[model samples]
Target: MSVCVKGDTILYGSDNYLKIADAADPSNPIEIGETSVPGDIYSITVRNEYAYLADIFNGLRIIDISDPSHPTEVGHYNNIYYTRQIVVRDNYAYVACEGEGLKIINISNPMKPLEEGSYETPGRAYSVALKGNYAYLAATNSGIRVIDISDPSDPFEAGYYPTEGYAYDLTIQGFYLFVAEGAAGLRIFNISNPLNIKQIGYYDTDGLASGISVEGNHAFVNDGIDSLFLIFDVSEVYFPQETGCYKTATANWSSAVNGELAFVASDGAGLYILDCSLAPTLLQSFNIRQAETKMELSWDISSREGITGFKIYRTTNEEQPMTKTTSPTIPITASNHYEYTDNDLINGKSYTYTLAVRDSDGSESVIGERTVTYKLPNIVYLCQNRPNPFNPSTSIECTLAEPAHLNLSVYDINGKLVKT
Candidate 1:
C-alpha cells in the first residue's frame, strides 16, 4: 500500500521496488509502473515521475516512472551500509543508513545518481523526513536527530532528542515532527524551534508504533504487531488522542491518507484501501402507522470529512442497476429529518425504497434495503416512502417493521403548506 500526496500518487512493494501511481481518484488508482532492484524495499520518494528507492542490502536505486507502467532503471548508488529509508530534496537524497549513520546522494541527473557524502550518527538510523533545509533522522533507540541540510553535500547534526525507545519512522507537518517511537507510542514534537526540539505531548497505545503520516490535524499510525491502523485526533496538539482504529486484512508495515481515504500495506494481507466517508453510522429504515399518509424520516448526523446529507430514492425495477438519475435526494442537516406525503400515490401499489448518504465531496453510500408492498390505509404496513420523487405527494405505510413516531404532512416546493 502507498500514501500519496493530495496531487501525487505512490505505491511500495517488497519486491525491492516501488510503484508510482496517479491519485486523481482516491478510490480508483492508476499505476505508473514498477521500479526494480535487489534487497527488499523499505521506502520510496517520488518527485515528478522520478522515484528514489531504498533497498535494505542493495543501497539506493533510482528509476524514472514518468510512464508509470514501464518504469525503467536509470541509475543506482551502492554503499556498504544497510539502507532503510530516504527522502529527496532539491538535488540531494538523504538516506537512513543503518549502523553507519545517514548517507546523502546527489541526483541532479537521473541517469547518474552520484554519492555526495555521508554523516555518521551516534546510533542506527531507521527513517528520515525533510522540512525546509532541515532533516529529521529517526535514529533507532536514540530518538530523533535533527540535521541541517542547508549544504546538501555536507549535512551536519543540529540537535537530538531521546524519545525513550526505538524510533522506527518519523514525519513532519508545519512545525511539528511526529515520531513512531515503538513501545513508547507516538511522540509529538514542537519544532517551531528547530535547533531546540522539544516533546510537547504524546499518545501511548498497546500496539507498537511502526510507521506514521500526518495530514492537517489528523495522524495515521501503523501498529507493527497485527496490521492495525490507528487514527488519532491531533487537532489538539498538546493532548492528542486516538479516535478510531482498524485491522487491515494482513499485518501492515506502513499507512497513509489524503483526508478522504486511508491506505494500509500489509506484508501478508497485501494492500487495503478504506473509504472513511461517514463519522457515525445511520439506521437504514423507519416505519410508522397505517393512518399516517405522511411519514417523517431522519438519521444520525456525522462529522467526518466528505459528508453531505441524505437522499431518498425509489426503484420499481429491482433487477435494473440503481443510478443517480433514478434516486431523488431529500436534503437534511444535523439530523435526518424529512417529511413526505402520499395523498396522490396509489394506496395499493407495491414500491421499493432506499436511503443514500451523500458526502461533502459528492460521494454517496446508499444503505442496504428492504422492499415495501403498499396496501389499504387501515391495513397498516408502515414502511418508509419509496421513489421519493413526489411532485405533490408520496406514501408511507405502517404494520411497523421498526419503531417510528412520525408527523407526516405535505408542502409545496416553495415551503408553502398544502396539507396538514
Candidate 2:
C-alpha cells in the first residue's frame, strides 16, 4: 500500500480500494470517502480534481475526487504489467510497472488514457521521478535508470546508476537526487549530469531505508526494518549527517512533509504526524504583505528555553545563497509578536524570506520560510471579463497603483446597475 498527500487530503491505496481521508489534523486522520478499484491499488498521485491509482494488474485507474466525500471512477487503462508507482506530469502519467519497466500514458483525456510509450528495464521498476525531459526510475535490482522522455511516444534509456542495495524510492531536489536504498541506507547522488550520476555521499541507517522526503536543508527518511524516522542535515548536498531520529513501533512505509509537520505512513501505526519545526515555536501566522514600495513580514512566537533571539534571511534567487538581512542579536521575548518591513526591494521582483532562531549557545535553527513577489505599478488597469460569450458567472479583474477608496460598478448591456 502507498499514500499521497495533496493539500489537506490524503489519498491512501490499499487492497482494492482508494480511500480519501481528511488530513486537517494529520495525527487523527478521518476517512471521508473511498472508491473500489478493479485490482489492488499500490500507489496513487493526485492532481487537480483527479486521483490516479496504480492498480497492479489493473494498470491505471482515474477517479474524480472533485467531491472528496463521494469519489467516482472516471477512467481506467489496462495492459500494463503490475503497476507499482505513478507520477503524473503535464498530460502524461508515468507508471513504474514492475517487470514491465516504465509505461508513459497520455492522460489529456481523463475518460480515455492511452499508452504513449513504454521502456522495458532490466529490473522491476518500483518508483519514478521526472526532471526536465528525463525520467528517473528506481528499478529494484537494476538501480536507477535515466531515460530521456523528451519524446513521450518513444522514450529511450540515456544512462543507468547501479546501486548496491534495492532502490525503493528516490526524490530530486535541485541537482541532487536522494535515494532510499533498502538495506544500503540513504544514498545521495549528484545528478547534475544524469549521464554521469555520481554517488557523492551515503548514510547507513540502522534499518532498511524504505522512503524519503526532502525539505529545505533536511531529509526525512523512514527506516522500515528498525521502525525509525531519521532526519539528516542535507545543507551540504554531498555529505549528509544524521541530526535526529524518532522510534516508531510499526514499520514506516513512507513520509511527506507540509510546512512544519512530517506525515508518516506506517504499516500498522496508521499515520503519524510529527512536529518538525525548529526552536521558538511559531505561535500565530507568518504573513507577507506588499505595500506601495515595501514588503512587510510579521510573525508571532512562543518562547522556548535556551533561545537567544531571531534572524532573518532574504534572497532574490532561490538557487543562489541568501543574505542575512537581520542581526543575530535581534531581541525576542516570550509570547511576543514582531514585524519587519523591507523597503530595499525592487518592484515586480520575487524574494524569499527565511526566519531562524538562535540559542544562547550559538546554535541556530531555521523556523520557517516564505516567498513573495512584488506587484508592478498599475494605474487603473482593467481586464476584460472571462468567458466573454455567456456563462452563469464570470470574473473581472482590476488593478490600482495606489490605495484609494474608489467605487467599482458593473452594469448590464442595457446600462442597468447589476453589481458594484
- Give per-residue CA lDDT, model 1, range 1-420, as digits (tens): 333342556566656656666767756777766666877777777777777777778888887776777888888888738888888877888899887777888888878888887788888898999888788899988888888888877889888998876899999989998999888889999998888989987888688888998766678889978678888767556656565788877768776676667777788566667665432234423443334553333334324345555666655553355432322555554554444433333455455555556767787665424356545444445466764876566676545333457665767799999776
Question: Which runs of model 2 end up more than 4 angstroms from their true locations?
Answer: 278-420
- Note each model's CA RMSD in angstroms: 17.1, 17.7
- lDDT of candidates 1 onward, in order: 0.71, 0.83
Candidate 2 per-residue C-alpha lDDT over 298-346 given as tens digits, one digit per residue, 9 for 90 to 100 = 9876445567787888998744789757864577665568888887765
Screening candidate 2 with a backbone cut-off below 3 angstroms (N, C-alpha, C), the clashing residue pairs are none
| Number of the top lDDT candidate | 2
Against the true structure, what is each candidate's TM-score?
Answer: 0.64, 0.66
Worst 10 residues of 1 by lDDT: 295-304
After superposition, candidate 1 runs with Cα above 4 Å error: 1-10, 17-32, 279-420
